[model samples]
Target: MGAGLPADDRARAIIDLVRGQGYQTIEALAAQFGKTTQTIRRDVNLLCDRGLLRRKHGGVELPPEDENLAYPARQVLNIEAKRRIAELVARNVPDNATLFFGIGTTPEQCALALSDHPGLRVMTNNLNVAMALTRNPSCEITIAGGRLRNLDRDVVAAEARDFFSRFSVDIGIYGVGAVAEDGTLLDFGLDEVEMRRSLAQHCRQRFLVLDHSKFGRDATVRGGHITEATAVFTDRPVPPAIAGQLKEAGIRLVVWSDDATHTASSNGRG
Candidate 1:
């Protein structure tokens, strides 16, 4: 099924397959996908370095449960794809709009994309997002009060959820730790899930911003489903099942990759 895909796309497919089966040997993957072991090795190596997979003896598997890739590494993984997604998401926000920016490097990129917009009021738990929005002198930033998570450089705790619940915003933008094949959103901790749900509940329009790698990824805590979002911005096409769910829910779906030519959107509800 993955044989005819582009190298990058095939890599993504390999991940989905591995995620489904827990682990997959390079030879098995190569045979299943009709690719040579050498090609599969290259794919596995790239995905492993990106923290999307971990190399086993003769196979690859998902990263350790509940623990995500280091924040710094995540910041650079698929960076160009992130920028493209961020830019497209920012374009949809109007000046002076109030927003809830959730934690994650992707949301940080969104903050950077929104820097050029004037008069944005952003409430976030992400220190990085707050710092990035500082570039926009007109943006009013309100940060949550909680013990900062030094590694992720964000706050995702009960206090953070309370802080977000205090204000209703025009738009809520957030990223998830993973997207289960069944369309459920997953995060590393219960606090993170609570905080994100609070962000979405208070917003008039919730934008779920994620990248292709998020699909079929693994995370411990289950949160709200992706269909809850008013709109989703991603760097690649979603799995067919997910795309159908989004369409059925009347949620807008936008696929804007680094390759501008692949950008597309289907209008739905706010």
Candidate 2:
């Protein structure tokens, strides 16, 4: 007897089978599921729209090759947690102090948190962060000059690094791609890695603003180690293994939860 299945279940099963093989043509999926080509086409389109898979010329595959593919959607995910982290960073900023802001959504939120603060000098490589600070008339904002990277929305050429080197700041707030168990920070591109390193040198104290997802993954390049940072502001508690590593390296981990009353702080010295 043929495999018994409901219509929806059969469609899902076909998708699962094709996805497991990497990518399959429309004809192949339809043949395997014993369905009409039109039905499979509709399923592929629906899955593509929902971001479950990507539609291509021949058939459906995974998402396209783009370094910053999910970046645009990241601002909406875990938004409340990011806001809380941003507020905590803002509270730590001294009034009228010069600060360096790095790229990504977390730093963008930090910029928003500081919007009402007056008389602050802010320098950054991120277009979004610079734009966010523009609404605050009392804040002096400057963008580092460099080749603008469209994908990441930041200036990251050698010129930008040189421009950032010209001034020193009291604090540097940066967003990193990943934080390793051994405390190494990682990012996708070398130019971004270099830019972050330059910003780290120009500031007296460095603060890494990251959310929970960044804790365990490592990207292509290393930006800096966790020990280089004065403090890390994250939305939730880190894994015990990662936390222990940070502590051994002499770094401070500060977690800001949704509850206003609870704050957890720990320190490690390398």
Give the candidate number with the greatest TM-score.
1
Candidate 2, after superposition: displacement of residue 124 in Å? 0.7
Record all residue pairs in model 1 with backbone atoms less than 3 Å apart, i.e. clashing: none
Deviation in Å, model 2, residue 240 alpha carbon = 1.8
lDDT of 1 by residue, 1-270 (tens): 677789977987887898798999999999988999999999999888878889999999988866788787698777888998898898899999999999999999999999999989999999999999999989999999888999888998666668877998899999999999999999988888999998898999999999998999889999899999999999889999999999999999999855665568876786
**CA lDDT, every prediction?**
0.90, 0.80
lDDT (Cα) of model 1: 0.90
Show where candidate 2 strays beyond 4 Å. Answer: 1-70, 267-270
Q: For candidate 1, report its TM-score.
A: 0.77
Q: In model 1, which range of ten residues has the least summed lDDT?
A: 257-266
**Model 2: worst 10 consecutive residues (lDDT sum):** 64-73
Candidate 2: residue 21 Cα off by (Å): 16
What tens-digit string does per-residue lDDT give for candidate 2 at 42-85? 87876666555677776888664233335564565457888988
115 in model 1: Cα distance from truth in Å? 0.5
